[model samples]
Target: MNILSQVTRIKNAIAEVLTGKDELVELTMIAIVNKGHLLLEDVPGTGKTVLAKSLARLIEGDFKRIQFTPDILPADITGIQFFHPKHQEFEMRPGPVMTNILLADEINRATPRAQSSLLEVMEERQVTIDGETLKLPSPFLVIATQNPIESHGTFPLPEAQLDRFFMKLPSGYPDFHQEKEMLHMYRTKNPQDTLKPVFSLEDILVMQQEVQETRVSDEVENYLLSVVQATRSHEFIENGISPRGTLAFMRAAQGAAYIQGRAFVKPDDVQFVAPYVLAHRLVLTMEGTMRKTKEQVLKEILESINVPVESEAGR
Candidate 1:
C-alpha cells in the first residue's frame, strides 16, 4: 500500500484501542514516520502503556516493556557479558532495548545512571558493549511513559535526556461518549486482545523516507526559525528552543503534511505541530511557571508571532 494509506490504517487501528484520541494518535504516527521517539506524560489508567503496545502490534514489530525502578541497573537494560567455564569465552546477551518498540514504563522511576544508558541507544540506535557497538533493529522507536501526578519515587528526566524525545505528549481521559463506548467494548474482552497488525516494518521505513522527501519551502522554513527565535526573546521564557528543536519542528511539519496526503508542507502544518514539538523544550520564567501553564504560554507565543504569507512566485 501507499504511504498515506498505511498511515491512515495505522491511525485507525490505534484508534480502535484508544478511543477519542485522534490527535494524539496522529502525532504518535508522525513521530514514527519521522523516525523519532515519543515521551508520554499523563496520569495512571490513561492507556499510556496500552497506546505504546497497540502501536507496536499495529506495525508487527518486536515489543518489550522495561519497568524502571530505583534499583534498576544499566546492565539490566543493555545486557551483560558472562564467562563460560568450558569454552573459556564470554557470551553476550541482548537486553529489551534491542527490540523495535520499547515501552519504558515509569521511566522517571529509574536512577540517573540507568536513565542515561538509554541516551546512546535512543540517539545513535546502537549499544556499546565492551568497546564494541551493536546495531539495533530497523525502525527502533521508544515510547516512554511517565506518571505526571506522582513524584514520590520518581527521578525527573534531565534536560539532556528530554532532548532525545522528538515530541512530548499527554494521554488525557476520554469524553463521556467515548468512555461509554469503551465500557461497552471492554465488556467481553480488552480491545487490545483483538488488535491486529495494520502495516509492516518495511512499510514504515518507506513512509519515513517519503516524509524526508516532503517539500518544505524557504518561506515556511524562515517562519519556523522565526518562531523559535521569538521564544528566546520572550520575557516569559528564560531559555528558548535550541537549534535541535528548530529541526524537530520542521521535520514534524513535514510529517504532518505527509499524514495529510500532501507532498508539500503548508503554514497550517507548522502551526498544528508547533506546540508539541516546542513546548517541552522551553524553560519558563519564574513568574510564568508559578502563574501560567505551558499550554497557555504556547498559545500566547503562537498568537503573538506573525505567520508569514508565502508568495505565488514560489508556487
Candidate 2:
C-alpha cells in the first residue's frame, strides 16, 4: 500500500478509540514520521491516555506506561543494576524507557531531577545503567501527557525540556455529539481493547525514511528562516526559535507533506504545522505572556511574514 493509505489505516484505527480527534490523530502521525516525541497538555478526562494507548495498540509496538510522581527516581525510568547471587554478577534491568512506545502520564508531576532523566534517553534513544548503555528499539516514541489545569504538587517542565518536544498539543474536551457517541461506543467494551495493530514497526520506519526524503524548495526554506528570525525580533517575544527548532520545523513540514500524499513540502504544510512546532519553543515577555499566549504570538509572527507563492515554494 501507499504511504497515504497506510497512514489512513492507522489514523482510522486510532480514531475508533479516540473519538472527535482527527486532527490530533494526524498530528500524532506527523510526530511519528518525524521520529519526534509529543507533549499532550490538557485538562483531566480529555482522553489523552486513551489516545496514546490507542496509537500504541495500532502500531503493534511494545508499550509501557510510567505514572510520573514527585517521589519517582531517575533510575526508575532508566533502569538499574542489581546484584544477582544466582548469576554471581550485576544484572541489568531495563525500565519502561526500553519499550517502543512509552506513555509518560502526568509527566509534570515528577520532580525536575526525575524528569531530566528522560532528556538523555529521548535524544540519544539509549539508556545507560551501571556504566553500560542499551539501545532502545527502533521506532521509539514517547507520548507524554500532562494536566494543564492542575498546579498543586506539580513541577513545571523547564523551558529547555519543553523545547525538546517536537509538538505540544491539546486533547480538548469532546463536543456533545462526540461525547454521546463515545458513551455509546464504550458502553460495553473499551474501544482501545478491541483495537488491533494496523501497521508494523518496519512499516513506520519505511514511512519515516520517505518523509525524510520529502522535498523542500529554496523559497520555502527562506520563508521558514524568515519566520523564525521574526520570532527573535518580535516586540512581544523574549526568546525565539533556536537552530534546533528550525530543523525540527523543517522536518515537521516534510512530515505534513507526506501525510497529504505529496512528495514536496508546500507553504501550506509549513503554515499548518508552524504553531504546533514553534509555540512551545518560544518564551514571551512578561507583558506579552500576560497579554497573549505563545500560540497567539506565533500566529502573529506567521501572519507578519509573507508566505512564498506556490511557484516559488515549489521551486
Query: Largest TM-score belongs to which candidate?
Result: 2
Residue range 216-306, candidate 2, lDDT tens digits: 9999999999999999999899999999999999999999999879889999999999988999999999999899998888888888888
Q: For each candidate, how many residue pairs have backbone atoms clashing (under 3 Å)?
A: 0, 0
Q: What's the true lDDT of residue 67 in model 1?
A: 93
Residue range 183-262, candidate 1, lDDT tens digits: 88788888888888888899889888878988888887777787888889988888889889888999999999898888
List per-candidate RMSD values in Å.
1.7, 1.2
lDDT of 2: 0.89
Cα lDDT, model 1, residue 97? 94
TM per candidate comes to: 0.95, 0.97
User: Candidates' lDDT values, in order?
Assistant: 0.86, 0.89
